[model samples]
Target: MPNETLAGLTILVVEDVTSIRSLVVKLLERLGCEAVCEAADGETAWHHLKRRKFDAVLLDFELQSDDGVSIAWRIRGDDGLINKAVPIVLLTAHDEARIVEAASKAGVDDYLVKPVMPDRLGLRIRAAIDKRQDKLDRQARSTEVSWKA
Candidate 1:
């Protein structure tokens, strides 16, 4: 919709709850993602991350077996991941300060509360991607400057 801001972008959605995962997939499709992959748990999500490159990742904060912050940690810390620098958005029902702080330290780009609205979801996704891109651009520029010196 609206020229499809996320058109042709591949994304990963990791959520344990079947209903919530389905809802997120539907929303991503509506947002015009070319390919949206789903993972029910951290293991499945890790499998996808290792094998495929995603433009962004949307993770549920609480899963049946693992938490989203831990997943974010692996994504950021592990050099083996195909998309280690990819933007991550954490979704959660809890609004606790500690949860947000942990996610932030784990390199999560954005956080959203449960029962996400379409507009807010779109905004958050865009913001996360933009923020990550900005960081990458800065890193590239720093490397260029260092080489020039």
Candidate 2:
């Protein structure tokens, strides 16, 4: 059965390896995502990011042309992106502490080590989205308070 929270979300899956990318896409579909976009590299992923708004991003830590941290940084920093504050779940084979720290610093909302299990993937994605939403909510509240002050 599909998860209710993820049922209607549009997601972007970025991975260099064909098989892994396919697996991730299938998993997202199984979770009932409304739309699943694919990108084999950071460039393509950036193109998708700029052109479309995704509920969440599943980004590979190591890509042939670019790294997930850099892409995450770009997403967080780029004002031109349709979804600059979109939730990002970094998928990586590396479980190193330094890498995790870097990803956190880059503004990734969650991190998952490969091979990703369906249950865990769903949890991570949902968590990331919730985290982003919480931040947005807090920011909005702050802005409103300041405006009324």
Candidate 3:
């Protein structure tokens, strides 16, 4: 990967806890992201998504109003949203197989347990972005091929 690959990226962080959100934003800044927006709940995050675009979303598993799984599901299923394909990385305290499975089924691109290390978080973000980009490229190519036929 290129140096400071995340330098121009905009990220949305959805976490109900103020301290966690702040910590994540700080780390993202240090990791070279240009912008990091914070939302305390799923509804707020959805609103932000409608108003602006983000390169990725970091979502907390437990929120006061909406859980990360439901938020991720809504994002993936919502046909009207332009940011539907945005990569979602779920953060949670649980490391159980059930939690990870549920997150995967909800369309989360990545999962990280609590007390996330900066290095691991950076790696996860890079992986998720690359994965999303690859999927978009494949879809675009398929569409082009279909149109040519």
What is each predicted model's overall lDDT from 0 to 1?
0.92, 0.93, 0.91
Q: Regarding TM-score, does 1 or 3 come out ahead?
A: 1
Tens digit of per-residue lDDT, candidate 2, span 70-124: 9999999988778799999999999999999999999999999999999899999
Ranking by lDDT: 2, 1, 3
User: Candidate 1: deviation at residue 54, Å?
Assistant: 0.3
| Total backbone collisions for each predicted model | 0, 0, 0
Clashes of 3: 0
Q: Which residue segments of model 3 deviate by more than 4 Å?
A: 1-5, 144-149
Model 2, poorest ten-residue lDDT window?
140-149
lDDT of prediction 1: 0.92
Badly placed stretches (over 4 Å) of model 1 are 1-3, 146-149
Which candidate, 1 or 3, would have the higher lDDT against the true structure? 1
- lDDT over C-alpha atoms for residue 19 of model 3: 97
Per-residue lDDT of model 3, residues 99-127, tens digit only: 89999998899999989888898899989
- Cα lDDT tens digits, model 1, 72-113, are 999999987678999999999998999999999999999999
TM-score of each: 0.93, 0.94, 0.91
TM-score (C-alpha, index-matched) for candidate 2: 0.94
